[model samples]
Target: MRASVELPATLPESLRVQLGQVLPNDPNLRRPASEAAGDGVLVRLGGHADYTTVTQKAALRACLRMPSGATLLIRMATGSGKSLIFQTATRWWREVSRDSLKPVSIVLVPTISLALDHERSSQAISGLETVRALTGDHSSEERNRVLLDFRQGNVPLLFVSPEMALGSLRESLRELSLPDQHPARPNAVRGKLAAVFIDEAHIVATWGRSFRPDLQRIPGLLRSLRAIDPEIRTVLLSATVDAETRELLRTGYVDRDGRWLEVAECMPRYEFDFVEHRFTDSISRDDEVLVLADVLPRPALLYTTEVEHAERLHQGLRRRGFERVRLFTGDTEPSERRRIVDDWRDGRVDLVIATSAFGMGIDQGDVRVVVHACLPESASRYYQEIGRAGRDGRQAFAVLCAAPDDFKLASRMAVGSTLTLDVAVERWLALLEGARRTEDDDPWSGMPQYRLDLRARGRHIANPRVGERNRVWNKSLLVQLQRYGALEIASSDDDSDGWVAVPRAGNDGLWDATTCKSFLTQIFGARAAEEERAREGIQAFKSAWRVRNDCRLRMIYHIVEAGAPELSACGRCAGCRRQQVAPPHHVATGGGGESLWPDSLSPPSATRLLELTETELARPVRWLDWLRGRGVEQIVVERRLASEIAALWSKVERDAGWVISWDLVETRSFRPMNVPTALVLSEKSGTELERLWRWGKRWNDRTHQVAWWVALRGTQIGTRSLQDEGAAGIQPPAHLPSEE
Candidate 1:
């Protein structure tokens, strides 16, 4: 018997038939859990220590072992200890790194409410007393004090929103990355810029493309930091990262040459009894919600898609004698948002009528009911909203009272926000025409950079608010172009008035009509694909509501979990109740049954092979000097060796160049620069090496400045093979030991 399944005697016939098709004869739904006691890590947590799960221990170990220039993706279920990963890691770093200046980490969240929630929760935890949330609610003096504490290393963990990360705090972050920055204490070296954690990372793919473009620019900020210190890490924490969201994150957040690792516990939430209803129109839906509000459960959340609708619904509920309900939306003032969250936590408010703005990382344990007054835009959103309930290991209810018009509204919202290719191109050209070349332009480099006015409008537009609308469209166009490898945005002003950018080396063809059209077509196609996926997700939710032949939980699991083999009909949903089966005993827990860092998988090696020297092999610094002296524009090495070499080169030459992977090169998604670059190769297979060699030859033929260095262990090949391809190779010292 697997940990995920416990058979109930005398199941209903409908559930029995459905479970027979999905579950194997002897199902093994979970990986073996960890047996090692987490006493060492827990003891360090002081008062916050509790019984740690296998998944939590594994994630913590992986986070602690994470090296510089690496990206880690954690996809656990909601209510699991995702926040503990950063909290513990920050404290552990401060304790281990014995120095006058301690390390600091920045956590970027999606909403101010989540930030405040974290700030409030940290008050009870040891070593996190100094954690602060910097949002618009703070006065200028308070914000400056927080920044001063951060600069002086008094604040170990800082919570902020993406808008502040790229805006007011941008210069301070850049300063932290500089290697020569003076330490606050005399004769003490400055502390390292530890890591950047993005909570609710799924938004980078969802909301980042449309309303909040700053999420997409986070990678650009990281690149700037890596240029100075190549070892700074990036950690993405989320409860749900589906296939599409995972792909977007890989291309946008993960470095082409750095390591990318994922830890997942993909168990669906099973503590909720689901019930859905469809009404003829808004009046009927309101009536049904009012009726359910009186009888369903206390401490509930009523979700709608629009702010006006949420406000109206809240007023209607209040008018009908529901005095404990409140409204929360994007337009809610910062002070009011804080009050609502505090009130909800303190048991002063029983219900919150909110849009998606109230979602993402708001942790409340006793929420018993979650009602949706309208349909969500996608399956992920719907799942996330409902996950707010049933988190206390108790039976909860999820009710959906939606109308027919929600389908059209959802479809329109999904497809209408994206700009057309024609509009994007028009905005791009307008911005270019209005752009002014910066004073630091190098004449011989052939890469002319300019600072464009984001407020520049197309000549045909004559609206009174053209400036604001044009600024938004301009930023959106820049984000799309950068994603497509057409341009590289260097930086932007806090006021959102202008940004500095340069066209990629090989992307000069973007100025040509045919080439530009073809390139923009690919970019627009990606957006269209996202919209289509969203529509499919909406349709799946609709099927779960309208089709009653199967379990509604099974339909949702197929959409959210996708390929997980664990499939059993949760006997508590409305469909099972209709078949005359009583709800079974189930307790919702936060952890999963999988071991973190499994034995079958090898963790990334921490050995620094570049430090080894032999009589026959030159020193790593000498090798870098030789390549730079020869004016080699690019160097190729294996992926595992690329990070060490990059760090060494950054230290020796004071120039941390880009590391392009074979995957990114193959997809043409990397930015091409005239400066020296390194390309990572695969050393495990001969077929892959040959393909890489052939691609390198073709690339050299076009670029005319290519160099290759292969890190060979014991294998020997003819030197003529290298000369034949106009490349160079390097072998390890004969006495060097192989990596374990």
Candidate 2:
């Protein structure tokens, strides 16, 4: 008799091996995790006894088995054990290694506080030692000692900020790398290094182009490091890397042939309740604090955008008889910052009023309330800041207290001051002229000798805007120029407190007066447009703040998650809580002649239906059949949706042997039916769709159905209550795709 056995193929090879040892598998352990035995190999996790959740265990299994040169993007929500990936991967590498030839991992963080937090956390893990932080705060001797220890294989894990990792850290690695070709050779730097882990990797996209250009250099650093350590793996950890940022990282870091592991879990580990307190007048700051004092428990965090706000709040709380409150900000001395942080960690401080800088590296899991005195600049920032709370998997509150004018104030602070296109062009040309003056006489030399103080360069700007006066002029522009191959950033001069800029080789034409002006105009125009959109988005956020009939947590999730699946109403936020407390007695209605568009049939809901339609479109053979297979019933029960599915099915026909097409256009009077049409839109058809939608929904009652289609393309959307889309009446465009 011939018998065959099957085994779970997804398990990591090492874990599968261990499981096989324990279960003999009933003759079912057959498939390997990878073709190569060593590829998916996992070693026993030594001395670590905590039981991991299913999500964490799956992530760990994948990490242990991940191949060299592969990039893993882990987008688990906050408090979801993001740190465990590297922690366990380090142990696995160590256990798998022979002799003292252990693996070295570099963890790049955004702040010194985060580095220190990681260092402390790693020190607590068993079988892990020499966990050091190489930050600006370290003394020269200490930094050198850490590097020496790393070179000698005494240090296994080193944490550094993005600046140090890309600059000084890369320099140290290059200087210390052995002049050996083979990674198998003993004492070779390539053989010792295993992975480069980037914590909070989303900054690469969010801040890389602007204030923190060093973040963009991470790809270059990873490329160079991987050249030395051919098997070097890149792991990016973040709680809030949006879709755009993920695409940017993928293109920047992952090679075409390499595997980019995307392990994303947006589900919340703890229940979160969001409360928005909008002030009618600016005088409500005191009232906001008083309300918070009454509502929130002790050991809460209050986040402010400015240091002045932190100070004012701290003083107000102190006067209000809150004794354990402390203040932390950029202005705080290093020693005082450390003491305040330590006090908070040791439970000595009950309430801490701090600027945005206070929460990044903090690991206090028991923080019950996180109050934002001002609106956060972006949804991502808001999510991350509030994530500091509820780490202990308990109920937590994320409170936002904003005044009527706060939206305007936040937008100004968020967008910062920008130079007009013409002003920016003038500055670019002037900088280019300065570089020209500093160039060497030697024909081969393209480097500049002049170094101007960044502040002084800003001072030279004529009639700068209010916010631009104190801002660095070329902070972002110089980086853009460098990226465009128009210039290079020569070393930063500490004595001059500025950076030297040089023209790139074979790029002198780019600095011509006309070309320079054109480049600046184009770049600055794009920047201004992006800033304007951000301002608009902030305004929308303010409007969303006034919303009281929907779930606030779900709204936030929709904002941050972007294109991910829409989550159902959490029914736990302030809005939901209020609804629970006082159920609406009756919803107002109009007369019989008045249109009563069902809440479930709104344009937003129509967009959701279109998303489902697209999913069915993926398999066109049974496209119509799948639509009729209770797709709408899964989300909501609507007879109109069922009828719409039947109508769409009638329109679908075999275009090719395996392909199908659906005709969506109807040249008739628009009815008040919640029918969604699936169309085979092309480059030209998109315009026609827009034209038809505008024509059909031209009346004031129906603003525009086409606008809904555009809004659904990006951003996570929540299910909104049915709003009036007016009774459809007008005739559609003379030519749609079907008509054409």
Candidate 3:
């Protein structure tokens, strides 16, 4: 008769070898709590006499036998051992469970920093193979290897960002590869993914609420994961989220019932502390990014929404005679980001001019400060951004400066985010230019399409847009370009929108790219030609992020963060350096409309508003009218969205202010392009006015262009509510007394 033995289903054979002393039923017999080295691995947690509350023991055990749990959501503070739970779970599957192949797993992270961090953490455990990170951070060849390895069961652990993992998984796979020497492993990837770990799972739903459409694809992505990978496992992790999001992730992705599964089969071990601040006009000095110079002793980081702010602070610091200052931003290359991180870790640079992309998976442990010169878009984002502070159980500082208009700008950006097919390619090319190889007969084609050769020229690409292809440069370029007197992004088509020429004097790219053979391989040699051109195009838009309006800081914050930074400045009353929470401010705004168009549906008020605008405010913003008005309003009384036009307006209006400088609004802000006295508005700007009144040429002139669209939208929308009082259709919707 076969030996009578029992084993759980999740574990596989290769992992079965390390099983003997694994299932310690004698809870007290677990590893001693004192020497419990949770480093690199989340070990010796929640079972012994002195098993501290720090391990979240009981909660984890309860999840193991949960009746309706099929998914796990670990909502812990930033710096918390969120990933440890996963590492532990992976180990458990290897040591105790029984199955065929290693309980194959996939780890999906939101950023490369997190990916690398997880890679290190996951690899520390024994019997874990095929552990690789799939991100914009890797080379085309590296990513190809990762995808191929996972497909052929060569890699047991795979980490990736939601963007690549969901939207371009197929494309990424098509680009799969292996080293040339390994002929035995030709074409070995197809339908072999066990479980998927959705790090930063909040994007699955939160992005929609905040206006990030790239995130809109998330819900479907989750469903598709299950469909695509037969036995895919999912582990979602985030900190400081609301119950609604929790419910959404759990119900929408994991479990059918109200319960959430445990990913590491471990409890949440986190301690949260919200430290606030208040600042005033006195906080910022003229000619200075050094607004807040003093930093905590611990390895702290400063998160500024705008690079202008960062530049200003950096310049100010220089003026203040501080040297070890190093700034990290989208403009900086990956290698630079890595170098800066390493240098600071090694006590080389004192401060880094960091953008949002600066701190994703950084385990600086003792990060003392996280300053927000501008506000983030939401409470959720704020928590995530500031969570970067205080990792090593040491005190950390998170300072947020509140400005009233921040929210509107942030909302506009949140609503407009989408993965432009062409834009993604453009970013890839720009990175390739610096890495060009002259030795190849087909120089351009030799350019690597997927690899981040961009990282090689770290100093040249200092602080590249975080997430490179993930999400950076939307704002930093705008702010920095403005400071450099570069042309504004949202300008006449003839002008260079994203074209950033190498500085004739200090530009390192010229020397790097034109140098020797070694330099080529170190930078752009691997990228394909098609990809090189895409970079040039994306380079054009990089400067466009900071278009401006009355809501300057808000827009700047929005464009830079990519997700609106919340208006902690509520009404400009909540000051960070001081400690004051003010009520939310507003422009005293309201609008109406039902079905703004004929074919489209809209909120009853919106549609009715559209009808009124036909005679009241006069012409509509567009044929789409109520369907896509407000530039950023995703919900026009229920209709999801019918037009990208409305989205573009909101995006430019919201983000330009933050990323673009105020100088760009009224005049060309750089040399050669003399500072003009007047500005030009798009022709569509005047459409909000009644057709009859539009006959007047004043609004059409470039001089009065700025007010054209504002008046149009204001009048058309302002007159919406008063349509019923139109006095038998005699007078058209006149500009309201205050607005006119």
Output the TM-score of candidate 1: 0.72
Alpha-carbon RMSD to native, per candidate: 14.0, 21.1, 26.1
Which regions of candidate 3 are displaced past 4 Å? 1-69, 96-100, 128-130, 171-192, 208-212, 228-231, 255-259, 262-291, 295-298, 318-321, 344-350, 403-740
Among these predictions, the greatest TM-score belongs to: 1
Give one digit per residue, the lDDT tens place, for model 2 in 646-702. 333334221101111111113221122333322222212244444443433442235
Best by lDDT: 1
Which scores better on lDDT, 2 or 3? 2
Model 1: number of backbone collisions: 1
Ranking by lDDT: 1, 2, 3
Candidate 1 lDDT tens digits, 273-390: 6777677797767765776566556789999999999988888888889888889999999999999999988999999999998846877977878889888877778888898886
CA lDDT, candidate 2, residue 151: 63
For model 3, residues 610-629, the per-residue Cα lDDT tens digits are 22222333322343233333
Off by over 4 Å in 1: 1-36, 46-52, 180-192, 434-451, 462-465, 502-506, 511-514, 578-740
